[model samples]
Target: MRDGLSQEPSIEPQIELTRENLIREQDGDSKSIIVETNNSKTTKNSNLHNVIIHPRLKPAPFKIRDAYPTDLPKPTEICTVNDLKFYQNEELPVNRRGFKYKLCKPNPIFTSNYYSTTDIEPYEVSLSWFDRSTGSYLSQDCKALTSNQGWRSVRSNVGIREGIYYFEFKILKSDDYSHVRIGLGRREASIEAPVGFDGYGYGIRDVGGELVFISRRKNVLIEEGFKTGDVIGFEVHLPSLSQQKKEIEEFVNLKKSEIPDHHTTKKRKTNTKNKKFNNIEDNEKFNEFNNILRDQIPTKSKGVLYYDQFEYTKTKMMDHLLNPITVFGEKAIIEMDDKTKNIPIISNSKIVLYKNGVKQNETIENLYSFLPTNLEEIEEINLEPNLKQQSNPNYKNNDDNTLGYYPMLSTFQNGAVSLNAGPEFEYPPENTQIKPLSDRYNEHVIEEWYWDIIDEVEAQYLDSFD
Candidate 1:
């Protein structure tokens, strides 16, 4: 016998049997046999008990219990405490490659390195500059300062030049919609104005939950600003060597632009006029006019000429440069002295702000270019004025390249804030994928994804069963 399709010999054996043989075969209980015959034949007995058949079965879907992850941390618990909680399990399950844990806990190594007590040292506020007599020193470390007057601020004793730093400010007391600022700044930042009121410093302030940049010349509104009880973290990254050089060059160029050349030209005109006039009376009149001009023009001290008359004295000019007028909008214009106007110096580096554990969005990133509602009105006010010119040597003494930034705090009347930088930091940052003050030029970090094959397998199995 042969198969009809393949035309090949059939594997089943030819059974030559009669009724007795059939009965014996059934009694023997052969499992599976294909009966074939070279000649025509028929079974003599019918026995169903001896025969068996097996069918293919599909596998059941994998069923995992809900209690698999018994140790996932709660977000509320993480928020209540000051210290950080870290988890070690970030990889996928060993048995199931398709499944993965999100590892929501903060990175332990990063958190430790960031809030390490070994790196940062303790510093106190300068009593000579801030209103120490009125506001109480809230912290035993002497880092925190507060005042109820319209505005009060203090500079940190330690200054930072290059390196990533993390610090925080906690609002202890303030009225509704109170102004709060946190940022890095130089000594030039006026003690009277908030931290970012001057171009030398950068700060983020709260105005109706909106973060605004407070600079000497401009007040730019950004995203949501922090309020009372909010722990605001600041990450200050100083400029690189190349960036510092570029900024220094820009400063030099600004210096050249600020000093006017008209004084020399006007003096030459007077000299030529005097040469033409031989009359004694005319000479006396010219001398009188020259004296008046000399008093009106700014005096040259060293090589730099002072332009802003309100900042006429050498000390006042230094104050104007260091302590900027902090008022925003048209108020700044109204407060400007009638005599002299000054422009702000924009820096190359920047800092980032964080609330709780999450990073602030990039929309409000740079505090240097922030502006309030009335931007155009603020820019029109001039900072330079014609004033009595005198020679002064202190104008050229500022060292642009070597200048470092110190942390500053300002308190409006009835507002108070506290500071923390390592050692005694009450609240450590929650998310620590990157170091503080590192990577200021990039966007926020995104989480990675793992394969989800379990869902597909379950769906396919259900469809087949149905």
Candidate 2:
């Protein structure tokens, strides 16, 4: 029935399916046999049998392209564990917690045998002058401070939590509208405001010699006012360690209870596609990789030759006024629990004022009651925690040091004052028990020695882990 085939075989008819024959067969012959081949020309004919080809059915060979930038600069070399030894031998700049660096200064007092080998001159622990970095409108030497427009306050470099210490201040100049307020303030006290504008500070104004706390003034403390030439003295006495242990424990417990449970907090929903990569194992691996990468990347700031990371001065919790006092009895007290019996009390701490070496009759007492009682109160007030405290969980627990009070000075328009943290005072306190502010140098040396030992131990512990 086919034209290509013959019944008789007198001579075998030879035929080849060439391009022309295939084309001719395809044009008219529906019953033509189709052949599939690897050849490029046959590919088109391979689908001639009403067959459909989808683009997604067969994937094409892929060639990956470079996605990263080629012209990126190489990263600077980072410090490693092995490189720490080299840094120890060299004098490095002191780096504070908030990425701040203190400018270089000579320390004559720090001539200890421990630091004799290195050129690293440690900073003096004693309060020599007002801190220039922390205070505005301060002189270059930090001894004199002035305010032009509004109230500007400055705290001493060092502060004390316990012991009876005395310091003197002399008003250099004060205009007709200008005034000065001298007091002690915690780190949380605002420099932009007067010393006693907030709860964290307790001050006395020169205008009326009135006692000030939480912006409220009480004229009963000092009857006579001081002038520009008068030398004002402050005597601070804090409770000893034995008296504060129980109270500190109770306060710590209250703070612990106030901290909300992390599990109870609402969590953000993760992407469905990325759920597989969000597991703990993956996170651990990522952290490990990140740490390695960080070690290879430099963290040094510009112009810094060499430096060491140090914890910045931590800020304490803000205090609240227990009860508004109009007048004082035999003793001014702030009770922790008014209803509870024998509850730990924050009393006996006193602040004595002196005008021109003459001791004032009135003494401000019971200071601890004004300090922060619990951590919840701190959060409710929206107080910001320090960098170290925010990052380290155990920081609060380990730092049991009581809220320290620093000599704070505030001035009004065109007001100026000079500090006298001295070995020699123009008007020294009559009390022999109360030490001069210069005696803090001994305490500083002792504290430094203790810290040095701790640092050595920490380094050894880290080396063991490595």
Candidate 3:
């Protein structure tokens, strides 16, 4: 009785339990004892409002060519931070060592190479051609993979169609060939892509309007029939318009078939004896060795290499186009299909050095002065598209011919990604105009890596925190 009376409930600590009575309850029998002391310091109680930004997640602000170190991200505003400084001990948990950011540099880098990225590659090639036949889809034979064709490398690199590549193409031409168009193998154009991304990729067009050639640098030009032999190069753009339609029909107003790029060498009539000097070697090997030393004479002597003919058609264009050639350097000359004296543009499109921006009525040879002085600046230079403006002024779906631009569009609504259209490559000069991407229109919404090369000082600060 005395023990019960002496047990004062006020003095006897009545341990309280949380909602989880059993979980938080202290195991003590009316005895006060310490279990856990709040001695271990952690980030849980950190002053998030005043905490420094994490260096890992910090973003570097934008700047011009010459910027100061202090011009970097600085915590000026209460919310401003160079990086969101996350503590090592986080309750929710994140792998500290697993922290990663992507480092990518868009190809054909330009001044405004804007683009978006998916965790994975864009599955289907997507393109909305400027062609009039929108609803009706068509499939034509195309070799997007041949070396001479502009698309050879891109096809293999991008992983199109599973054997079939499950690719979609939109011809810029309104008409479909009675026969199938053949082969759009691989050709990639990551021209003027935004920094830190791969923006310039090729996608087939859907319209059959006259081809509009644009330099990688944004200079627009028109092409005519081959005068002198030139190396012509073009990109194969296989765009997946929509899975709903399988067949895409394209009719060529130009009446040229979509085939292989024609590579023909001029045939030279060999006098059994040189009409100029009759000691021409009888044996082929002797003539070959003689020709090797032909250049030994000051003026010049030449030889010929014979090859078969390959055909090509601009299904995407109302007129047939001679794609620009990849200048492997030096001179490249080819003859016409008929083996006539007509000069070919197929082999010599890239032959003349692109020295200057497109000039008014300037011959291709005169443009050689425009070669980039700085090789390092080559990556930033945009190549000129060897396409001429449509001959027909009343071209279909014609916009302002003087100020018109066609940017890459998406396939599905809120799905397809836009091509890189940025200004990282060349700085647009005054009086020049910029064609907005929105003018062309995009059906899908856009969503958006690169590594930070922290300086030694920055590295030390980051390591010190670690």
Candidate 4:
């Protein structure tokens, strides 16, 4: 300090260091030590010691284990049954919509006022008349026969031939002005062939209840009854009234081989163009006037399933219409007299079959070919018809005089709403029996993905090191 400048006593006190940190730069000074951190606070105990073990380890056994992994494949098959054990967490499908004729407000309220059981009493009645042609019941003048009760029972002849006449009974209040509950009426028509000519014809409600039209001729015999009409009838038939609803979830497979594609050629004057818009071309101009729209249904390749002939049957009591009934009373019982007679056959047929289109032999032959080669063993027997038709009439109808009144044949209303019919009932049962794996829609690829994911997840494990 004296050589650089002038020597001087600074007004500052010098303090000596008592503690110092010596950081070694050489690697040889480094060493591992135990430190306490929040994460590794267990080492704070002085008793802590390092553990050394071999590389290999033995797995500890567990008393129980889970068989399935988190990566288990989802079930692709649908849950059809409500209580399916495989899918406890899922809900089964159901239809909540009820029948159209179900008791709903306003409709029922309206219907109940008309047939108020609490207020009105129902009645039962039958009608008969004399016929100059048949000599049975005298054919009464229909209008004259209908007691003035706001309705007519007039017997008037209609159709090309004259003999077809209807002795109609309609819904009407009694002349006594007594209101009645009109449910349904039964028809028991028993006609006898005249001595010389024939007596056979058909009847129906051409436009429903408005008019009960009979095809009075030698060739066509139609008979019809009604469950609903405006004029209250002379009487009504009452049976046990009940209602039931059924949910039909069915599977119907269409086989291409059975019902082959067919086409019929005929003359038609209808416009045969697609109406993409209202605009008409010269050829389609014919549609603008008469507006007759004609089109050919485009043919499509046959598929595995087809929607055909769908019918719904309900046993529910309809408020407006009465359930149909077949006669078992004396009105239908008949005894024919022995006399010379010329009979007439009545029909409403457009197509006639010599024999039914039953391939009975073909079905039998196919079943035989499917037998086992060695065939000493027996298989369970299945004796059921494979194909079906509407009604299978077992006998023919005869109108000859030799046929005295035939035991009252079964009678029916042409417009009676029937409960569902045909093979639709069997559909649900068939859909249930099919296995998922056997179906083409459920392919093998789905199963392959399931096992692959399951195995891969099961292969993963927790760290073996402790």
Which residue runs does candidate 3 get wrong by more than 4 Å?
1-49, 53-150, 153-220, 225-358, 361-456
Point to the candidate with the largest lDDT. Answer: 2
Q: Return the lDDT, model 2, position 18.
A: 30
- Clashes per model (N, Cα, C within 3 A): 29, 0, 111, 33
Clash number for candidate 1: 29
RMSD value for candidate 1: 34.8
Model 1 lowest lDDT segment of ten: 111-120
User: Model 4, which residues run further than 4 Å from truth?
Assistant: 1-144, 147-154, 157-159, 162-170, 173-466
Model with the higher TM-score, candidate 1 or 3:
1
Kindly report which residue stretches of model 2 are placed more than 4 angstroms away from their true locations once superposed.
1-135, 250-345, 369-395, 400-403
TM-score for each candidate, following the candidate numbering: 0.40, 0.54, 0.17, 0.13
Cα lDDT of all candidates, in order? 0.36, 0.47, 0.18, 0.17
Instruction: Return the TM-score for candidate 3, rounded to 2 decimals.
Output: 0.17
Q: Please report how far candidate 2 places residue 92 from its true position, in Å.
A: 16
Please provide the root mean square deviation of candidate 3 (C-alpha atoms, Å): 30.3
Q: Write the per-residue lDDT of candidate 4 for residues 1-466, one digit (tens) a residue.
A: 3232212221111122111211112222111111212222333322244432212111111111110011211223322111221111012111112100100000011111110001000000111121111111111111111111221111111111111111122322122232111111111111221110111111222122121112222221111223332321111011111100000001011211222245222222223233222111322333222221111011111111110111111111110012122247645533232111111111221111010111111100000000001001111111111111112111111110111111111111111111111122212122333221112112222332343233223222111112
Candidate 2: tens digits of C-alpha lDDT, residues 111-228: 1111101111223222222232222354434455665567877777567766888888888765468788888876556566788876667888887789887788876555667767
Worst 10 residues of 3 by lDDT: 292-301
TM-score of candidate 1 to 2 decimals: 0.40
lDDT tens per residue, model 3, 1-466: 2321212111111223123222222332221111222221323333333433221322121122101111111112111111212011111111112111111111111112111111112222222211101221112111111111111111111222111111122212112221111112211222111110111122222222112222122122223311111112221222232220121112111111322245222222333233222111222223332121100000100110111111111121111123333334696544223311111121111111111122223222100110001000011122111211122211111111111112222121111111222222122222224222221212111111120111223433432332
